[model samples]
Target: MSVDVPRRIVIFRHAKADWSQESDHERPLAERGRRDAPAAGRWLASAGIAPELTLCSSAVRTRETWKLAVHELPQRPRTVYEDRMYEASLGELIALVNETAEDVNELLLVGHNPGMHALADALAGDAEGDALARMNRAGFPTAAIAVLTFQGTWKSVEHGVGRLTAYWSPQE
Candidate 1:
C-alpha cells in the first residue's frame, strides 16, 4: 500500500552578500547578513521544525548562511554542498529535490535568488493570504525563509502542488 508522508520544505535565500568582493561566487556575507543568519535559524527553531537534510550551494555567501543558521538547529542534520545549486535554475533545483530520498521528511535548501524567488512562488500553489502576497512582491530577499508542506514524496512534487505554510524574514 502507498503511504502518505507529509513533506516539509524550508527554503531560504542566502543572507545579504558583501558585493565589495571581486567574484560573485566568492563574495562573503555583509555585516547585516552575518547578523541575520542566526536570526533566521532562531526563527526556524521557534517554529519547532528542524530539517532532516539540508542542501546548500557552494557559493561563499550561501555556505556562510548555512553555517551560521544550522548551528541553531536542535540537532545537526546531514548537509550537502552542491555546486550546481550555486547557479542553479529553478528547474535544476526542482530536479535536485525530486531526487531526494524518501526517508527525509523535512528538507532545507539554502541558495541564491531569482531562481529561489521563482521556485517559492511557483510551488506555493493557490495559497492566498496577505503575508504570501507581501512576500511575493518583495522578490524573496536575502535571508527570507518560506515553508511549504505537502503530502507526498519529493519526487511527486509538481508545480503548484505544495501549500505555503509559513513565510518569515529578519525584517518581520
Candidate 2:
C-alpha cells in the first residue's frame, strides 16, 4: 500500500467471557458473548471494514470471538494468535502494530482492555463527530470495536496520529 493511502485499524475487545474457568486465558465466551460476537462481525461486514490482517490474542475468549467475527467477513484475513497480546500493555501493543508489514493496508487487533481502550484513546487525536465521546461513554465494553484511520506507514503509528472514525458496541 502507498504511504499516502490511509490505513485503518480496527481495535476489537474480546467478548464477555465465562468466569467459571479456572484459568483466565482458558475461559470461553459466555452465551451472550457468543451472540454479541456475531453482531460485531455483522457490523464490520456492513461497514465494509475488511482488514488485510488480524493480530489476535491467544486467549480462548479472544480466539473464539475472532472465529465468529471472521465468519461474517467476505474473506478471511491472515490471523496470528499472539500470546503476548493476552494482557499486553499499551506500549507493547503499539510495538506489535508497528511491526506490521507495509503491504497490509488495514489491520485488526483482537485483544482485551484496558490496553485496547488505551490504544484507541491514545491514537485518536481527533474524531469524526461524536465517535470519541461515544467510545468514552461506552467505556470500551466487551465486543466493542473502534475504527481508526491514519496516514503513514505502520512503523509511524503513534499517539495522536490517528482519527477515530467509528465506535461500536454490542448493545448499540
> Which pairs clash in model 2?
none
Residue-by-residue lDDT tens digits, candidate 2, 1-172: 5668789999999999999736998999999999999999999999999999999999999999999999999999999999989899999999999999999999999999999999999999999999999999989999999999999999999999999999999887
Going through the candidates in the order shown, the clash numbers are 0, 0
Shift in Å, residue 151, candidate 1: 0.9
**What is the per-residue lDDT of model 1 for residues 6-94, given as tens digits with 9 covering 90 to 100?**
88888899999998746999999999999999999988999877899999999999999999998897987999999989889989989
Over 4 Å off in model 1, which ranges? Answer: 1-3
Quick one: best lDDT, which candidate? 2
TM-score of each: 0.95, 0.97
lDDT of each: 0.88, 0.95
